[model samples]
Target: MRSIYLRITQPVIKLMLALTWSLASLQAAQAGETPIPVEKFFKSAQFKDAQLSPNAELIAFLAADNDNRSMLVIMNSKGDATPTVITRYSNLDVIFFHWVNNERLVYGISEKDLGAGEKNSGSGLFAIDKDGKNSRQLIDRFVKAGAPKFRLLPARTRFISTTGNESSDDIYVGQNSTERMNAGINLFRLNTRTGQTEIVAVPPHSIDFLFDPSGQVRIATASKNGITSVHYKENKNTEWVQLYQFDDTVEDGYSPVFIGTSGQFYVTARNGKDTAALYQYDTKSKSLIPNPLLALNGFDFDGDILFDNQQNKLAGIRYETDAHASVWFDEKDKKIQSQIDALLPNMVNLVDKGRSQDANVRLVKSFSDTHPGNYSLFNVDTSKLTQLGVVNPDIDPAKMAYRDSVRYKARDGLEIPAYITLPKGRPAKNLPLIVMVHGGPFLRGGHWNWTPAVQFLASRGYAVIEPDFRGSTGYGKKLHQAGWKQWGLAMQDDLADAREWAIKQGYADPKRVCIAGASYGGYAVLMGLIKEPDLYRCGISWVGVSDINLLYDVSWSDTAGNAWTKYGMPKLIGDQQKDAEQLQRTSPLQQASRLKNPLILAYGGADVRVPLIHGTKFYDAVKAHNSKVEWIVYPEEAHGWGLLKNNVDFWTRVEKFLDENTAVK
Candidate 1:
């Protein structure tokens, strides 16, 4: 490979001119608005994940290596050659890569200096050649005991999707099926250059798959006891067929998304409407077509559907409502997304075009709400954009922090959907707030970019918010079935009605608010300090869930024997022997002696999701009569904090526990 790109092309051009002179001297010492540190808002992102190569004339990304690990380079989408690297390791860390055609690429690795409880679950998979030549490994980073599995493909085989046939190196893997409890995912087709294999059609209790722009597979999806289903097949010698099933905690049917090249399928449902749109299904009358083809208003068709397969149609959809848009339906990819949104007129650009039908290169990406994203390239017959880096080249979008997207009313009139943010040259009034919360209290919390723990609590001056409250999930179906079993009652009163609507819109500081989260937002920060103890003046809760009947008595939680805790946690969280006294009146280790303010409680002694016995049994029952609690733990972290020195030692102990409890006095 030209003497290995002439021996690392002068240390990759002196690491891209010392990362462009260290991002121009850290944006000129963050133009005097200093504060931005706590490990540059939790590290890891020196240019990340960019993609583009299925002949969009090369681009690939992930760069860091000067020992910050990641490393996978490659360039030239007209930025005229030179950038090569192609792979690196010295210990491991190319976490996920793609492009299996347009001169090969596939990737996976991981172990970025251990500590997810001493890592190692399977990152393995390799395969190279973009000029680093025929590299290879193809799966085996750990899975040994009795090592002799002949056709070597173990270490839990993954990488699904990328067979849109760029003249085949074939690539649709998946492996999972450990034989019983919810046994699904087993498809394969391999051969990313002769590690050869070809099973390709399991479909029994499958857990999601949907191929078709000629690479085939045609839909799959599964679920179990609480129902779900949706199977289908029309090629590779047919025979799969189940089609429609539903009731997986009802939002009524559909799902799939993408599989057309004339065999059309596309999905996303909630047909009786309350959100979820995008339609077209009809595999000869299995139904679904009742209008729609992309709906959104209150959100829920969530994203992705692009598909262009050398112009076999449907070239855009993208979605994600409180931000992250894209419509296109192909008018030259909607005039190359309005010429890269009239030259990045305030971020959120996107524009992809990977499996290119060539409207001259594309890629883009961009971002906003205090920028933490970049990746460029655009071109489109010489209009140009170029760049291709910066995902946090020392941040500083004028000292980060804007976010916005509001909406309130939750003490019954429903509405909710939050995300505030503040703090960028302050004065959105009172301030000091935190309210953060999101840890999938049923997923989808805040979106509208640049969030490193909400820009590290708005670069330390605080004011954060977040909300999505009532059972979260891309807003719809009456805000996700209105907090199903209402854990800690009406999801802890929609986070104390988002701290009294951020202190009645004076942007917070009703006595300097506070309430943070992790896992189910650390079980709603110990049920929001035991149901709004004078509306939170303190509480943090990392890797939370202090005993909701130990989520069905923790039989080593991966959510105890899955199928989402036997049929989606008794229909969405609750029911441990029929809500035993409403799960001990909302367990925070059973109310930890009605928690008196000032608390911190972090965890992850190798957290198996909210594990170190949910922060050592709620810091041994709120330090027996709370003496201003503060716990911590981290023994090789998990449920969160995957080492950036434990996210700068747990946000520098949340900046001295919000400066000894809500600073502004």
Candidate 2:
């Protein structure tokens, strides 16, 4: 559409851009040459979710080579005892861990079925000794089991029960189906000495269960109409005291937590205009006390109550100023604030004192994201920090560019959150932009640390933008739920709006822009190529979901099949049959011909999530349409490429593709 003068000048512009790219490309090439493997940089002593033993002499933690296959390790606190791996199942994974005694440990182990013609299997209750010696299968059969910490009660042994459809051994029968997500729970008692398991509570449909100080069961059962009624009972008595009742909507918020050693409870309740925090029954006064811990006033907080064996006062994880701060109460109601303070240090001062502001620490936890996250532990008392290593050490902080958290108003007048990383040592002008969309369409992006992909893009003289589109978690429930079925509609538009916002703010060069993402983000990349063809000159999609309809129809036999119904279907994605028209319109597979940008599609050959078929079909469809497409598949990898060679290979291909298509300089 350009005039003859502009057309004649285009060749000179292309030449100049190439010359600038080659000169800048040399400096960028040196940045990617890491001394160690990128995977090694991610590993090296980053232990997740620490659990000190009841005696506080030994500790158990989960460590992984590269956040792939995690191992359960136990080490003594004061002794010169080397940490031992109690878990050794290559095929099966340990879900949760519990200390039954000073010498024994109990955990839930299950075989994860990757849905590539695989069958979904159930997990079982497994017990191992403290020394990793006596490894025994307590359940004896495959069943859906959960981890519950055991407390040494008076006359008998007991544990906090997890309500799932567990049988005699507290394990479910088999794998869950593709359509059936609902399951019930049963309380069971296991004798440590004899390995004998007994079913204690036989409620009809117990949805959630908690154990009091005396080991008596407080169960919340859901009726057929989705109404939850809380019942408290002693021993195996049929008579139950109905303490509270609530609609299905608020049942999740009413999740029980044991607070005091004398069986006093703490729960959050909605009172009038605000959800006032309420304490459990004060038997002497026969009234509920209004909790004064104003810090955890409105937000829902949950964690293990760290008690000092005597069980006199309350101590647990609490939040303050949007950061985790621990609160513990002494006998005189003097709350001791030291544990969280010891864990999360004032890194702002450390960053100001010679360290880069781009630095971050994340606590890695098992069940909860807030529990044990990626972070360097610093002793506030001693002012000494244990460097847990970097999340992306492959990218040098000195040479690499970084982004600070930024927010812009969206088209809907909502404050859209995003991270902007400008290349280091660049003049504040119209720079080439590469918008990197995160994988989880439902997971929100934040100021937390990330991997090498973002830094790598920025190192090549391009500004990177990551928009935490709607439906992402962390902001709040309302923001998270707003993304329900807005896949290609508002969700994708948010990304485009982000790029437009960047350009309008004079942060990006409109002539040189590209979109890149992985998995769900990959789908976004292809869709960006289709929906906004002129906005982007190139795109890179790795293991992206090409067809949402195909994903809905995916079926597996064993554990994978159960996950399809239980976790996948009802949680994030809607049914394709019901949302068929929307799926077709949103899916990238149907709009392959509309892909006018230079595209690079990367896929793992053994991918079970969005199977290799998704990539294969898209590649064939695009090739048939005569679209410019580059395809790369790692034969050994599944879902994600793990090998360091594969990582370098993918990035090298990406850089070259952008250089040839887009104005990278």
Candidate 3:
């Protein structure tokens, strides 16, 4: 490739950056009718996350400042138009925060690291008053370049609970144990006012902790091999009792532990059913109730049990299948939910309880399969839903593509669930398809909402297919279990199934179809080409696992080579000794010689999960045999592209690649 002036020349590159940023700003579709620019989708949301204060008198939201840095803004219920920029960071992204009370809030900052291992995100906790006054750094996570080494707590070291009133200055914080991997987690009551922390409770070394709304440590999960020990306690004074030990070898492990609002232990386990369903455990007797609290018809109930903190009542159980739905337990709240649903029948209305004493003003976020999200302040007193502001104001709901949940049976007669997205105002028939697989094969695959990736592909006049496949969680234990130890085998088959289904439905042009994904999905992309060589016309794999053995080899990487992966990989993925032959066959690097399709392979330099080694090793191997593979790398990126410029650059390459290969048939 010739050195392009826009990329190689420093002066021209600076000029291009100025030109690109300028073009990004001047876009507004009359009716979402014009093809939305790639930058529009990649641009940071005007408001990332917003929350109403305890009193509902004020709203706290995260928005980019003048320098494109994340900041917290405080405003009245009318919206943060003339808002007070309470907190600002030059580099860090204000990812998450919750109001400590009506007057105070604690927030955590994060840099763009989807899989940044050991690159301290400056996630240290901070607290501030409503006026942006008296801001204090409670926990300092930042480190100077040549400063003395100080170990950082877990990225999830977070505020566990707050009283939701101004009276309580102390917020419960969950800190990770610095000593051992087995030391489950420690709890501390940090005074937001005085910047002092009090050790509240410390549980035995385990993987994670389970706490109730009242700031009580109820359950702890410990792991050895694949067997996870669930330990529970009645109260703070009692000794921890063993609830049950589960072996993950069977399926992604049929288990879900959470403290329900009903004052009973809510768990999801396969008691007598094939799929893990909701079950209530008796804390007093230390036994399961043998019956489900709430079980859906087909899908596994995989949502939170709504708890009204102020009123101290169980609101309802919300779950997702084709789309998100809820079953309200509280009659009054149920009626309210029904009325809201009637009002916004096209969109799903997620209701969050208010922090006020009366709990009358509920915060509702309404969104549809096509639309992004709308923040609405629901006034319970007047039963009125007022539109506060949108998440992405540039995205017009009417101009977005149509998304539908579709189900198809795999070769083994197992029902496969997937989501299909079609371009707006375009004929769905004979469309080019991009089989976009989700990264976590164990987690839920596709959500029924406005996903930028899917919508972006759809905007380019291509149909997008995302299959949950077997082994994906939030569906059922059977499907999840079916994916156990099958990595590229059954999982790859599911991808093929999704493609064939789309072709059969007359929605996908078989000749113009391609494969693309990140992480494990990227691994699947490479394997799909290996297994079904003629199926896909092209492959785009970024930050993908090239070898199954790398999962165990890369131990220094935090999430990749950790306590949980060691014990779980043998059962969930594959045993190195037992399934060596299968793993060898599945490894993308080993089968690089088989590559013949036009492929775009990219990786993050600091990607610990799917490290740069995976990309380099595979790239070299492929280059030795067939040098047709186009390769790229984001030096500062961790896992996927998090920065705005990198994302736009990636999609620009993708759009150009698809246009070259999977052009409109």
TM-score against native, each model: 0.32, 0.67, 0.88
Best by lDDT: 1
**Segments in model 3 whose C-alpha atoms lie over 4 Å from true places:** 1-34, 77-82, 89-93, 110-121, 144-160, 163-166, 178-183, 251-262, 309-311, 559-561
Worst 10 residues of 3 by lDDT: 4-13
TM-score top scorer: 3
Arrange candidates by TM-score, highest first: which order?
3, 2, 1
The number of clashing residue pairs in model 3 is: 6
How accurate locally is residue 607 in candidate 2, as Cα lDDT from 0 to 100? 78
Tens-digit lDDT string for candidate 1 (278-333): 87788877887777767766677777877777767676677767777677755777
In model 2, the runs with Cα more than 4 Å from the true position are 1-49, 62-74, 79-98, 106-126, 139-181, 184-193, 200-313, 319-403, 421-432, 443-447, 450-463, 504-507, 556-581, 604-609, 634-638, 641-665
Report residue 28 deviation for candidate 2 (angstroms): 11
lDDT winner, 1 or 3? 1
Can you rank all candidates by lDDT, best first? 1, 3, 2
- The C-alpha RMSD of each candidate to the native structure, in angstroms, is 23.4, 12.2, 10.1
Selected candidate, larger TM-score, 1 vs 3 = 3
TM-score of candidate 3 to 2 decimals: 0.88
